[model samples]
Target chain A: MEMKKTILNPEGLHARPAGQLAKVATSFKSKIEVIFNQKTVNAKSAMSLMTLGIIQSSEVIIKADGPDAEEAIQKIATLIDNHFSV
Target chain B: MSLKIIGQKAAPGMVHGPIFIFKKGNSEINRSHHLFSDFDPSKETLLFEKALYKSLQDLENLKNKFTSIDKEKIDIIEVHQSLIDDPEVKEQTLAKINHENKFAYVAYEEVISLFKNMFSEIEDSYLKQRVLDLEDISNRVLFYIINPELNFSYFSYSQLNDSRPSIIISEDLTPSDILGFEKTKVLGFVLSKGSPQSHSSILARSMEIPCLVGAHELETLDLSKYTDLILDTENSEVILNPNINEVKSFEEKVSLFKFKQKQLFSFKGKKTETKMGKLVPLGANISGPLDIDSVIKNDAEFIGLYRTEFLFLDRITPPSEEEQYETYRTVFQYLGHKRIIIRTLDIGGDKEAPYIRIQKEENPFLGVRGIRLCLKEIELFKTQLRAILRASNFCNDLGIMFPMVSTISEIKEAKKIFNTVKTELEQSKIQIGKKINIGVMMEVPSLAWILKEVSDEVTFISIGTNDLFQYSNACDRMNNQLQTISSPTHEGFQRFLKFIVQEAKKNQLHVGVCGSIAHHPEIMPYLISIGVDELSMTAQNILTVRAQIADL
Candidate 1:
């Protein structure tokens, strides 16, 4: 699957969105990877995401692969679009 | 009478003799030579195996010698023991010794040196600390292989575990390693290698045990010589080798300290009201679920600010909702119908959350964070709120509050979410009890101007003066280049809080300061004077603050 690029809404992905992304990432059967800068981590792992320590409105790349890879990336993109504010 | 080092007297008593110092790194690095070269595949495998067993005994003996079991030291020994017994370290070295005609020392060096290089390449900090442990183990192995039956019976522990309290002098202590000392038996602690924030020191303070660190480099400092000691609590000073006159002075001061403490304790469960019958509530800032003990022991009437951040830090995984539920449940049960105002996840400032990735902001303090983070992360927020709501059922007086609130909209938004969670749990038939009151921190400037409008939406208000002052003058409180926000004595902050106090009273809502300003002895009387209902602070500052408030 191709990587999707998005500006992190609601400043950067803070405690809340990091948690939201973790929760959502855990929901699907597909494996999701989020890359910010050069660091890549499992988007489903809060521990891994937290270690990224990104701030507001950062450019983040979400990559996913599996049975629902397209749907997972779509859901994540929508979450970044909807839940994480301008 | 021997060469005396006036080190921190870790225990009380007297011992007179030539003092022997336990020196570290004294064992030479080349001590590994014979163990490596002599362990030939054809002959010395059995001898090599015999040496491994002997080293374990040496470790056991060293532990028995210590005033306490040094876990780091034990950890080091275990690593070395494991390495020696490993199939690679011994079998490979011995094979090389026999096949290649290498010396036993050369064979041994190859085994351990490989581990040393491997350890240096690992990236993790915790894993890196293990390299030192490995080296320490290597030293023990060298001693065990070379000396054979040089029994480590030289160490003694007659004075330790003698039913008398001790002032342990150590180079360092691990966070978990401090538990071996019986609390009552550890009168004080002095670390040659620790700080105010070290686990031992923090544990000592929480236990009300006196401690002083960074003055204990004299490891062999005669503990017996310094045993006639008194801990000067106020100064963190250990008065060593006290004469009769010095003892008399401390003894005289001891009663005065007791009397002062008695005065502080007299306010137990008492209203913060003056003789004039004005109610003045005293509260505390708690970091975790465990800090409630200090709050209860101090008899704090309520929890002012329950910092919910420590729940996330240093943990392997995020605390599940059930874990959060049990945690909050304990706080609620402990307080029992007393107001415990929990501040939700007030991170993204100096107290950063490791579990959440927030990008680097030019000014994180001014950036979108705090209550803002709460609104954006609904699932996590929902988990916390649900846990909190679940806990509130167990304690009717439990309350929740949001921190760094800048807008009335945030208050309205939180109230809405709180209701949604309450309803969701109700729909699930989760058997939660009682709806808890919610409050918003009035730290923003515009909120100060619009208190009547703001107070109508919330159950109570807490003035976060540390940030309120910082925001009021646009000064980063930590910035040395910026203007200082000193104390209540500062005219501007005094005015800001005064405005908050006056506005809060007019709106008929309870408001209190929960910043360091709350615990300031100098500021307490003024806060009382300004008509704030409650004062909340870190638990350690409560007793002295209560004393200062009693006067007003």
Candidate 2:
């Protein structure tokens, strides 16, 4: 599996919803890399997302490769598409 | 095999409606960024005025809705409206639109940003909601301003074919959304945002709805796939996409819950006493008159603590003594002279009071707050005292409590003001409750340690556990690192209670807990066992507290 970047438009990965996305992304037996701007980071990192201070209309790219690549992409993409609001 | 459900259960009823997620989509407008950049200054000014007019009109509509109280909910709209009308907010909007010659959308964005920063900085959850409510309203206002013709309808669960909603999942819910929903038809509420402290959670507690917040994998839920679901607020877990047996058990539990509620409500108007013959005077702490009806329904022994701070905060100045007096009189009259203990201005520390400015100390927990500030600012204290006293004659059982009393001198100073207010009311030839019971809080261990001495001066003592525990352990309960440090079940705290209990007995004075611990069920039994004379807690827990006491 190859990693690709996507732009994040919704203001900051705020509160715990960001951490939640990270947690869900890491739950699967997959290697996920979430790159935000110039900083490349792990998708499973709460601290990383918190430090990024990703504001609304910012962009982030999520790339994952695993046995369940389809499940990983589908779930992560759905989570992001929901504006990471939930 | 199941879709996930996560939300704060707002009101308890089962609904099987299709999931209609209320996304609050942005209302699109015809104006483009390029068009706005090229627009004439005169046109921009007109646009700003138009948007401002719409905002003001919406605010007026909100005022009528919140103030013209038809049902139970408080006029929280008034609180938000005050924020909207705040000088700081107004100045910011004026600067952004008129001075900067910015687009109406940019001006709105700047205003929202200002609110988000201001509200997020404050410590209290209830007050924080004040900011969030303002933000929500501002967002809605912006949405309408952008597209006046936009059709906006967002409900997490819709009643299709007139069936009850099965489960509602959301990121978070506004206070209005929770109140407007058909509570009886909603089975479970799960949210991506908010928890026990959020507005939705508080309402859910009020309605006894099964609510869960900060749950895992809610966004992953495809609720339409589920035929059977279980929404349990107590557990903060929703069992979705369940099998037949799980559904049967949940339905049985619903019936059982109804039976239990019947048993609970039967004791509604009756006194809450234990089987062991302990006179546990159950009183509800109220902040508003709307709460008085609940006190009546719950058969509250008395209004333990009437928080007067809510009236004082946010506004440019404190409410007029007449306004405060009238408000107090209404609640006191409604309760029919029941023992209503009015705690005077327990602001500062974590609570943000813009009117009464205090120097920002290094540690607010150890700063001059509560009684200290009240004593230092005698005029503020006198106004509040006079309001309570004027309402005193209207209600006979008017009691007063001074919070954050760390020493006897603080009580003495507070009492001196109390006496002055009493004499002033009398000297003015206004009839008042001459012999009112004045009490001091045992939040500081030093006060608890010397309760025997000060206990004689005041008629009674109320312990504020949230602060006491924090001070005793030298830990901030809100600090994630020290979260484990707080627990009443811990010995240092249990020992503290034991000391206070024995001290109250020694003084032959009454003792009650007006803290968060008063409602903690795990601590309640231990509290009763430890000689806590009276337990004053949240209104929602009063019934359950009574139930547990009955079980005892």
Per-model TM against the reference = 0.62, 0.59
Fnat across every predicted model, in order: 0.00, 0.00
DockQ of the candidate models in sequence: 0.04, 0.01
Candidate 1 Cα misplacement greater than 4 A, ranges: A1-86, B1-159, B175-177, B195-202, B214-255, B314-319, B377-379, B474-485, B540-551
Q: What is the lDDT of residue B111 in candidate 1?
A: 70
Q: What's the lDDT for all of these models?
A: 0.64, 0.67
User: Residue by residue across B1-552, what tens digits does model 1's lDDT show?
Assistant: 212233332222222112211234323534555554534455444445556666666555545644311333343334434444454466566776678876544456577776666556643333344455455555555544444555322211223445466666556654323434455555565566655643445555545666556665356455655444555545445555666676677777777767877877776666666666777777888875446667878878788888887666543234567557777776777675677788887777444454465667888888767788878877668888888887777776666889888888888898899899999989998766565677888888888888887878887888888888778877767777664453346877787778888988999888878988787767778888888888888776677776665566
Separate clash counts for every candidate? 22, 30
lDDT of 2 at A71: 87
Which window of ten consecutive residues has the lowest lDDT sum in model 1 chain B? B12-21
lDDT of 2 by residue, A1-86 (tens): 54453534222454344556766876788877777767765666543454455554466777787798778877887776665544
lDDT of 2 by residue, B1-552 (tens): 644455544443442223434454444434464353664555655654555556556545544644322222354443334334343444566577667877666776777775566446644343355556765556655655465544222222243215655456667877656655666666556676776656566667556556667765766665456555566654445666666676677778778877877787877766778897777888888886657657877778887888888677554345656557778777767874678788888887556554566887788778888898888778778988998888888777767889888887788888888888888878899988645788877788777778777866888888888888888888788888865666666887888788888989899878888888888878888888888888887676688788888888
